[model samples]
Target chain A: MSRIKACFSVLKESHKKALIPFITAGDPAPDLTVDLMHELVAAGADIIELGVPFSDPMADGPVIQRASERALAQGTNTDDVFNIVEEFRTKNDSTPVILMGYLNPIEVMGYQHFAEKAVKAGVDGLIIVDLPPEEADELTAVIKPLDLDHIFLISPTTHGVRLDKISEVASGFLYYVSLKGVTGSNQLDIGAVSEKLAEIRSKADLPVGVGFGIRDAQTAEAVGRVSDAVVVGSALVERIAEHAGNNEKMKKEISSFIGSLRTALDSI
Target chain B: MPEVMKNTNIDSLKSMPDKRGHFGNYGGRFVSETLMGPLEELEQAYKKYINDPDFIAEYEHDLKHFVGRPSPLYHAKRWSEELGGAQVYLKREDLNHTGAHKVNNTVGQALLAKRMGKRRVIAETGAGQHGVASATVAARYGMECVVYMGAEDIKRQAINVYRMKLLGATVVSVEAGSKTLKDALNEAMRDWVTNVDDTFYIIGTVAGPHPYPAMVRDFNAVVGREARQQCQEQAGRLPDLLVACVGGGSNAIGLFHPFLDDKDVALYGVEAAGDGIETGRHAAPLNAGKPGVLHGNRTYLMEDKYGQIIETHSISAGLDYPGVGPEHSWLKDVGRANYVSVTDVEALKAFHDLTRIEGIIPALESSHALAYTAKLAPEMDKDAIIITNLSGRGDKDIHTVAALEGITV
Candidate 1:
């Protein structure tokens, strides 16, 4: 089984919801990323979504966009992201690490080469924010055979044939964008999110992970009650931004935040 | 290389950007899943109304009365003589209402917005021509208008910014990467995704995901159709060459689409070579960059080896984008349309020469095409005809010109 599948199965068996924390891979500094990944695992994160910095992050709101800018300023690229994941795999190989970003960098690297390099570097899954399933076939064909879980995002806007289309090719988990807007914009209503989650579950067999407004332990707990996983991005990235240029402080902040969410999910 | 549409098969050549929006391997709906529903909705609306006679009549009626369509194909006799070779003709898009050919597409999209029952319209602009045009149409239609412009562009095109404001658009200054066209596009897409329910995104050019490229091209294709008819009526034959400047390539594609099957007429797309392509500071993606995805479509983009889009420079703010429309990429690959570059220096010279010789102040974007025409015209036979699209007027660029001359307006 893929690492992501294995990780989710383990969580399912334990009747526990997965806690996924996201951070830009090379944010603050490239050298700190591997350490940060290890720190995320230590803080009880079941899965880590590492952002691959792109110059234009259209889907992201201000917080994550700032993280991308900081990462890019540090000269981070796809190779650096892979290196970070490879280094993170040294001490811990069990926790699934999903690389998330836009599709251009991988396009420049070519689909086959990217999938091979990702697998070689111990990356478990991918979440290209801009690549919808209609345009995903070529990449999915190469990556899925290599046991790379090609995860997809399910938005509040997605329904009917479009929902079916995305569900058909998706693996690992379906990330449910909890709001209608870009990441880090607007407060998400739990009622609306759970309503959508129920709809998403009707079509896809994969676990549904809710994201895009879960900021605190309370919010994570609320989301956890209805989702197989809870994803917190902007809140963690905002914290990273607050502690940027101070690596130790940033790690501590991230660890504490993830630990709180982990505690909340466990309680749920 | 990807078995693009060969120059042969002119009949089917007009049906490009196939059903799934793949123009060869270039254009596709590469956007977030949140946007997929909206884009599919847009695609359906476009398909339904494009063939409907009611939509066609309404669009044409607005074009004739509001935008002043069939802008004259004027013979630049003095400039042609000064160039000393080809008899040059200008497809006078600069004379259109709102001072540019951009209004042609905006008017169509505004109409589409009305048909879809959208209460608000949004757009992204570079030189601010498209912004002003969108604002103008939105005001005419009584829809709420929001224009996303780069902070840098707002400074350069202050007059046009004021014009957009005067037309009642709320201009949002984007202070993001590069602070230019690409950044504004990113902001606009985000805005649309956020407010997909009540908003219609009027993409200024033939770029972006899927239906947008094809839809914008269709609306602006009137340029080629009119130019073709005008050239034959005035010059007594079809022009030997069709030339237009390319940024996101709406105007160029507009002029080139109708002429695609005209085997006798060659098409030239002039890209902005900022300092020069050799200096690696230019926005001439088809000339210097490689294929990559940006702003929802696969196209030739000015990106570093790592696939991060690099900043592009051009004196013409409209031309300072890293990527071209995907159809242009396909055309370049298939050897159908010729893509070339013009430096800022050359474009400035053309701007001055046209203003002096023809009493026509061409937009800096259009000046790039005129710059190439200045070179190519000198080499062609005097009897040869060249119809170049004056995409916009230079009134908005007067400040940039005066600053270059060290004279404060």
Candidate 2:
């Protein structure tokens, strides 16, 4: 079984929800990413979603957009991200690392080559934000053979027919965007998200990770009660952006924030 | 190359987008899942209204009265004589109500929005021509309008910003990456995804997701249709060459779409080479960039090796974009149209020359096409007819031109 499937199976047996913390690789500094990944794992993160900084992250709001800008300014490429994952893999192997970003960089690298490189680099899954299931066939063909989980996003607007189509091709977990807005935008209604999650669970048998506007521990805990996994991105990245000038403080702050959310999810 | 020739059939060229919006491996709905429903709905609406006679009649009536369609194909006699080669004709789209060809697409989209019972319309603009055009249509139809423009563009094209506001549009200044057209497009897409129910996104250019490229092209194809017929009647046959400047390739595609089947009529799309393509500061994506997905479609984009879209430069704010329309990419690949670049200095010279020779102050965007014509016209025979779409008037660019001359104007 793949690392993601194994991780979920372990969590399911323990009757524990998964905590997935996302950070843009090379944000603040490239050398610090591996250490941060390890920190996230230490803070009870079951899965790590490492963002590959794209120049135009349209789906992201101001917070994650700033994270991408910082990462790009530091010259973080796909290879650098792979290296970060490889470095993290040296210390940790149990936690699944999902590389999340837009699709253009992978397109430039060629689907087959990227999937091969990603597998070699110890990437367990991919969450290409812009690439829906409709456009995933070419990449899916290559990655599926390599045992790399192809995670797809299901937004609030995704209806019954599209949900069936997405669930058919998606492996690993399905990321359900809790709100109708971009990542980091406010106004996530827990009731609405719960309702949507119930509908999504009925359609797809995969573990559903809820994200996009889970800002604090309470929100994460609230989402965790209903979701198989709680994914926090812009909130953690915002903390990193706040302490960018001081790497030690940024690392400590990020760890503590994730630790709080992990504690909250465990309590739930 | 030989195989490409054998496949260049008129029917195949016209029957593009093939239901799934693939334009020969270019153009697809690469948007987020949230937008899929809206885009599918839009595709159906476009298919419905685009064929419905009542919708067609409404669009045509607006084109005639509001947009001032059948914009004259004026013979640039003095400019042609000065070039001393080809007889040049200008399809005067600059004479449209909003001072550019952008209004043609906006009018069509606004009408579509009304037909679909949409209350609000949102658009992204770079040079603000499309913003002004969208605002004009929104005002005409009494619909709420919002335009997203790059902060850099909002500063450069303040007059157009004021014009949009005057037309009752709330212009949102985007300060994202590059602070330009691509960023504005990103914001617009985000907005559309957020408000997918009641809002309609009127994409300015012949780019974006599926139906947008095809729909926008169909709306703007009136430029080509009129130019083709006028050229035939005025010159007794189709012109040997057609030229237009490409930003998101709306105007160029507008003029070239109707003429794509005419094997004898060559097409040229002039991209803005800000300093030079070699200097790496231009917006000539087709000439110097690689294939990548951005905004909503896969096309030629000016990107770094890591696939990060690089900042593009052009004296014309409209053309300063990292990507071109997908159809242009397809046309370039299929050997149907030739893409070239004109430097800022060359476009400035063309702007001046056209003003002096023809008493026409063409937009810097249009001046790129005129600049290429100045080079190509002198090489062709005097009897050779060349038709160029003068995409816009230069009034909005006077400030930029004056700034180049060290004047504040």
Candidate 3:
């Protein structure tokens, strides 16, 4: 079994929900990313999502957009991100790392080249936000044999036949965008998310990880009950943005925040 | 069927997209899953209405009455003589309602929105020509309209912003990445994803996901259709060459699509080379950039080695974008059309020459095409006829030109 599947199976056996902490690679500083990934794992993150920053991240809210801008300013590239993952793998191999971002960088690298590099770098999964299942054939064909899970997102608007199509192709876990708006938007109705999660569970057998607009321990705990995994991005990145000048404080703050989310999910 | 015959063999050109909207590895529906349903619905609706006689009739009728169709194909006699070469003709898209060729696609999208029972329409703009066009059609059809424009563009093209507001559009200034057309496009896509139920997105360019590039091209094909007939009657045969400026490539593709099969007519697409292509500050994707996916389709983009989009610079706000349309990418790959770049100074000179020689103040965006024509015209014999798409009027660009000349106005 793949690292992601094994990780999920272990969580399922423990009857515990997964906590995924997302951070942009090369944000604040390029050299600090591998450290942050290790930090996230130490803080009890079940899965680590490393964002490959792009010039334009349309689906992201302001916080993540700033994260990307910072990462890009630091002159981070696809190889740098892969190197970060590779560095993390040198220290910790069990923790599954998912590379999340837009599709252009991977396209430039060529699908086969990206998949080969990603597998070698120990990337467990990919969450290309802009590439839907309908258009994922080229990348999917390349990544499928390499044991990299092609993770897909299901939004509030996805329903019926479209939902089935997305669910069919999705592997590892299906990311459920908790709200209709982009990340960092304030309005997330937990009841609506719960309802959607229920519907999604009925259709797809894969574990569902909920994200977008998820902030604070209480909300994470509430969301943890409804889904198999709670994916937290903007809230953690906002802390990094806040303490960006001081690397030590940023690391501590992110660790403490993810620790709180881990604690909250464990309590539930 | 006869329409297909006037060009080259229809079978080769018409069989494109192949149901999945792929224009030979360029165009595809590469959007988020939330948008899949809406895009699929849009595709279905487009497929149905594009063939419906009643729908086509209504579209044609509106083109004739509202947009003032068959916009004149004027022979630029004095300009041709001055250039001392090819006899040049201008497809006068500048005379369209709302002062640019943008209205052609906007009107088509608005009518489709009405038919789909959408109560509101949203659009993104850089120079605000498209915003004004979208706003005009929204008001005409009595639907709510919102336009997203770059905050920087809002300041530069304040007159067009006022015009959009006057036409009943809520102009939302985007302060995102680069603060320009590409940023406005991102914001518009966000809005459409958020409000998929009641809103219709009217993409101004032939870029975006799947159906948009093809649909916009089809709507604006009137430019080519009329020009083809006019060339036969007025010039006694089809022109030897066709030239147009390409930003997201709506206007260029509009004129180039019908002529794709025409073997005799060579096509040239001019891109904005801000200072020059060598300066690394231009929007000439085909000339200086590589293929990368952005804003829903695979196309040539101004990106760095890391795949981050490079900031594009151009004197014409409309052409100041990082990517071109997917079809243009395919055309470039297949050698169906040639892509070139013109610096701001060259385009500005063309802007002045056309005004003085032809008594027509062309938009700076359109002036890029004129600049290339000026270069190509001098090389060809006087009997050679070249048709250039005069995409817009220069009225909205007066302030920009004035600022360039160190004038307060």
Candidate 4:
């Protein structure tokens, strides 16, 4: 079984919701990323979504965009991201690490080459934000034989035949963007999200992870009630932005924040 | 019926960007899932109305009365003589209402926004020509208009920014990622995704996901159609060579699409070589770029080996984008069009040369094509006809040109 599948299955057996904490790779500092990944796992994160920085992250809000800029300013690239994941794997091989970003960097790397490098680097899944399933056949074909999980996002706007299409191809989990806006947008209606989650669950058999607009432990707990996993990105990234230069303080704060989310998810 | 065309057969040139919007391996709906629904809806609307006689009539009616279409194909007799080779003609898109060829697409898209029952329209612009055009149409039609422009562009093109404001558009200054056209486009995409329900994104150029490249091209294709008819009527034959500046490639695609099936007419797309191609500071993606995806389509992008887009420079703000439309990439790959580059210095020279020789102040973007024409016209046979797309007027760029000469005015 894939690491992601096993991770979810174990969580399912324990009647616990998975906690996914996302941070841009090489953000704050490149040297601090692998340590942060280990810190996340130690803080009770079920899975880690490490962002691969791109110059233009259209789907992201200002917070994550700043993270990407910081990472890029540090000279981080696809190789650096893969190296971060590989380093994380050396210490802890059990926790699934999903690399999330736009598709161009991987495109430059070439699909087959990217898939091979990703699998070898111990990356468990992918969440290419801009790559819808329609344009994904080539990449999916390259990654199918490997153990990597090709995840797809289901937005509030996604429905009917489109929902079926995405669900059919998506593996591991379906990330449901809870709000219509980009990450870090303030408005998130729990009622709307739960309703959308119910509709998504009806179509896809895999676990549904709720992201976008998820900020605090309370909202994470609220999302945890209806989702298989709760993804917290901008809130953690915002914290990282605050303590960016002070790596020890940044890691400590991030650890406690993920701990709160984990505690909130465990209560559910 | 193949979803992706590998080879550009002459017969298939006009029917390109197959059903899934692939111009060979270029141009696909590569946006996030949230945008897929909106893009599909747009494609369906585009398909339905583009063929409708009512939509065509309405679009034409507006073009004739509002935008002053069939802009003259003027013979630049004095400049042609100065070049001393080919007889040069200027497809005077610079004379269009709103002072550029951008209005051609904006007028059509604004009409579509009306028909689709969208109450608001949004646009992204670089040099602000498209923004002014979009704002003009939105005002004429009584729709709420919002334009995303880079903060840097707003400073450079202050007149057009004021023009957009005068037309009642809320100008949003985008301050991210190089602070130029691409960043404005990114912000516009985010805005569209957030407000897709009530808003229509009037993509200024022939780029973006799907239906846009094809649809925008069709809207602006009137340029080629008229230029073809005009050249045949005035010059007594089709021009031997067609040249146009390509930035996101709308005007060039507009002129080239209709001439794609005309085997006798050679086409040239002039990209902005800011300093020079070798300097790594230019915006000539087709001339010196590799294929990558950004802002929703696969195209030739000025990106590093790591796939991060590099900031492009051009004397013309409109030409300062890292990528070209995907169709241009396909055309370049299949050898349907010749993609060339001219430096900012050359374009500035053309701007001055045209003003002196023809009493025409061409936009810096169009000056690229005009400069290339000066180079190519001198080399061609005396009887050979070269028609260059004068894409816009240079009034918007007077400040930049004046600053270069150390003159305040």
Task: Give the per-residue Cα lDDT of candidate 2 at A6.
Answer: 97
Off by over 4 Å in 3: B1-10
The numbered model that scores best in DockQ is 1
- Global lDDT of each model? 0.92, 0.92, 0.92, 0.92
Specify the poorest-scoring 10-residue window by lDDT in model 2 chain B.
B1-10
lDDT of 3 by residue, B184-282 (tens): 999999899888889999999999998999999999999999999999999789899999999999999999888887877899999999999999989
TM-score of chain A of each: 0.98, 0.98, 0.98, 0.99
RMSD of 3: 2.6
The candidate, 3 or 4, that scores higher on TM-score is: 4
The runs of at least 3 residues in candidate 4 whose Cα sits more than 4 Å from the true structure, single-residue gaps closed, are B1-6
Error of 1 at B39 (Å): 0.5
Off by over 4 Å in 2: B1-10
Q: Write the per-residue lDDT of candidate 4 for residues B237-277, one digit (tens) a residue.
A: 99999999999999999999888877778899999999999
Each candidate's TM vs. the true structure? 0.98, 0.98, 0.95, 0.98
- Candidate 4's displacement at residue B251, Å, is 0.6
Report the C-alpha lDDT of model 1 over B1-409, residue by residue, as the tens digit.
1123444343456778888999888999899989998998999998999999999999999999999988999999999999999999999999999999999999999999999999999999998999999999999999999999999998888888999999999999999887888999999999999999999999999999999999999999999999999988887899999899999999999999998867678889999999999999999999999999999999999999889999999999989999999999999988888999999999999999999999999999999999999999999999999999999999988989999999998
Query: Candidate 1: TM-score?
Result: 0.98
Question: What tens-digit string does per-residue lDDT give for candidate 1 at A185-212?
Answer: 7587999888999999999889999989
Error of 2 at B123 (Å): 1.3
